[model samples]
Target: MQRIISFLCISIFLISCNKEKTDGFLINGNLDNVKNNSLVQLFRAEGRQTVIIDSTRINEKTFTLKGKIENPDMYFLTIEGIKGSLPLIVENETIDLTVYTDSIFASNIKGGKENNYFNDYQEFIKKIRTRSNHLTEEFKLAQQKQDTSKISSLRKEYEVMMEENDANDLNFMTKNNDAVLSGLILERALSTNKLEFTKIKEIYANFDEVVKNTRAGKVIAEYITANANTAIGSVAPNFSGPNPEGKTIALNDIKGKITIIDFWAAWCGPCRKENPNVVKVYEKYHSKGLEIIGVSLDGTPQQKDAKQAWKDAIEKDKLTWHHVSNLQYFNDPIAKQFNINSIPATYLIDAEGKIIAKNLRGAALENKIAELLN
Candidate 1:
């Protein structure tokens, strides 16, 4: 009898393991305020579009969706005629969903480890937003009372909260390196510019093969390739665009001993403000074998004349550097190639065209130029 009991225990353990590692997904879903027989669709995001994974009809305000996914990927569940869709991390496990049809974004999605991580992250974000709203109200009160010290204190507190939040996100992403959510998290980290590019790349490389093949992962891979164009120690990609006179000018044509690629726009206020510092740096370093090629992102749909505005800003600011523009705003091919998101950006390269630094400004700009040339 004792031997039989031992055999039974092992059998039970193996059965449980098999159940846990089921082969396909099953979504047991119910809706609030949704009529019976309503249609529900499950969509999977491909490269640039979403393809339907499965669909089911609600019976008595309940529906079930079943499918097989090779990986845990982002899927959206939509109820017919609903204004919003419920986003879920679909894994090969039984998912329990409660659709708040009135506000679909508030829907509850509980499933595998991936969904749990995402839900926990959403809760954290909600708390941060609540604190931010409270801080905004406090700042208004402090302003109305003209309490300078209180205002300063609140500002510092806000900054601290943001820093802590960013750190928390980084920690989560690093801890869940194998999670599909890490792909999205790394993208956010880059867009916020909160972490160094090298650190971001390291974290991205830590992701497992499955996560790296997801849509989000593919997008980040593309961004990494584009951003590498200006990454330090990498040879800068040479580009040519129409100058202010409509004549084409190439980077190789005006390559100097120390070259500065300046990405800015006439409409950018910060660029306008920093023009003088750039002029000072250029005036000091031009005779010292430093050359600057100003790439202007001047075109905007609202602007009356893109080329005229570009020329005026250069002349008014007295920017004597060789300037070029496609007048295509941030859509400029060169800007797209460099993945430049903000203006007043700079890339400092050596005589061999290898990028040495990026986004330097003011004293940093002048000092780097001096160190290289002087």
Candidate 2:
């Protein structure tokens, strides 16, 4: 009877696992000049190309793509034909990608204000490309002339152009914040600028107020809220936790030196892999007023004896930095306050106790420190 019960349990678990799998879609389209040779690429909304489910040739006017996305979100469907290239978003089980043959779908899309946002977004893209090209030319000229003054002046001019571009983008979102482009721009703005948190919150609120009915609106609201709720520039929230040494430490006590606050865990493979790079940077810069404070997110004492994994890793990796943890895993107050949705998260706070950078890792972290310290 016990053997039969175990078999039944296993069967139920397998059935549940199979039910979790989601089906992808096929894009059926008709284009005038697209000679059955067009290529279609499926890119997840927030993933890399290497992880693409599929990129295949269109056998005919109709192309059938097959895969299961773990989540149902936006995916870019691009058609690369001999003559030209066209791209569109596929957001459902049945997506129609019909485009005119004579000229590639200049901007074929669907929906209401969201569609209008895409139209304006094409224009915005052109403007950004042009401005970026101009900046590139100016940089080239400055380099060719080996003129430091010209380089500085041109850089300043480029910065002004970028700022103007940001203002234009904000204005665009005021009316068309329901589109994915606006949300993307908003994310970029917040990610890049140190002084724009207030404006970022205002833009987020404006989107929330204006576009309340669309899918893009819902996603934008969620993203903006999450980003605003836990950001590096905001005061680093406090935590009281014991380190591997069994001594309790509070975040507020580490106030005078520049701190690189890192949140990681033993179970996270990426976090372990990234530690060596971090260790190198720490060794190189620790003496010149650089300090590291690690907050482990490992869970309670484990059955597999992984509870001491953090300590073992520190000893093996020769990590001499200050480390502490509440052993509550991600439920720790610091992780919640910092919005640490992912592991290996890092923040660079200046001696003034204000966070200056976040997610700076590997070469980028080293370059930033060299620029600031040297």
Candidate 3:
């Protein structure tokens, strides 16, 4: 009777140990051609901040990480001195990865099912980006050579490629609605203005409850809800901030004129490039009752340099107009009120404060201003 009781106790202990092993997550990675003393850092993004979780030194070009997570979440693996970090989904299971120092994106991530889906999507995006870059180069060369026909053809091809990419992205989201990766993909699509509000809502609704409960999923839902208030035909959301000279300005103060609420940032290359056209338009129409409020998405109080950068950009671009910002990059209250996910976004409000149009750029912007004012 004593021997039988001892055997039962040992069996239970062994079973408990086995359960713990299966419940915890492990990441065993082998890196090819990594530097002898390179350090790989693991980070998890929470809200707007990235928190470092752990760091490991490369030994024999291999490393291991172990932890337990309640559910799948995105984590980043970055090597010291690398330009970009590799993103992967970590779940409560063992995962094996093989990375080459030269090209981390092409690295193989095996074991985690979510990571597999995420990797496939990343590969697809890489292919599309390569093609887009090639076409952009060709278009620039054609423009320089004054080859209008070739330029037009390339432009058409570029548009087709973009449409196809969008279609594929939508298809992937729809097919993988239950996967956490779908939420991540949708969040990115929302930020890039690739998904309309209706489609965003639809895709979000189809997401699994677990996916919808994730941090990224909550952000997507919130963005869709906030954007509904700023849609065309809706009254423009009211906001205010300090101008460059430290005077408070309100959106209502700019009422009774055709106002362009320009969302931009000092660090945004596209915004800087688009500034000349905006300056031209402001110069042409400021006297014609057209007003622009440049809401800069620059600098937090923590980043004093962003304030100087904002001032420098305004001076260099000759943006002689009302400008304001809370100086909180992407966390500005006004930007949140208006659901601004990307820079270089604009809302054209009429005299009545109704949003008349959105994202009107270059010739489209000039044409819209002319039509409204003239």
The stretch of ten residues in a row with the least summed lDDT in candidate 2 is 10-19
Scored by lDDT, model 2 comes in at 0.62
For 142-248, candidate 1 gives per-residue lDDT tens digits of 99999999999998988887777777768888888877777766765666677887887888888888788876687678778888766789999999988888899
Q: Which ten residues in a row have the lowest lDDT in candidate 3?
A: 10-19
The candidate that wins on TM-score is: 3
Tens digits of per-residue lDDT for model 3, 84-164: 677767666777778877877566765445755665666666666667668868988998999999988987887787677
Could you tell me every candidate's TM-score relative to the true structure? 0.66, 0.50, 0.68
Q: Residue 105 CA error for candidate 2 (Å)?
A: 12
lDDT of 2 by residue, 193-254 (tens): 53355776677776654344344455445545655644667655556678898998876776
Name model 2 segments beyond 4 Å from true: 1-39, 45-57, 61-74, 78-89, 92-112, 209-374
The collision pairs in model 3 are 299-327
Instruction: Give candidate 3 misplaced runs (Cα > 4 Å).
Output: 1-25, 31-37, 44-50, 66-71, 80-84, 100-103, 116-165, 191-194, 245-248, 265-292, 300-304, 312-321, 339-344, 350-352, 359-374
lDDT of 1: 0.78
Answer with 1 or 2, whichever has the higher TM-score: 1
Residue 295 alpha-carbon offset, candidate 3, angstroms: 0.8
- When superposed on Cα atoms, how far off is each prediction in RMSD? 11.2, 14.4, 12.1
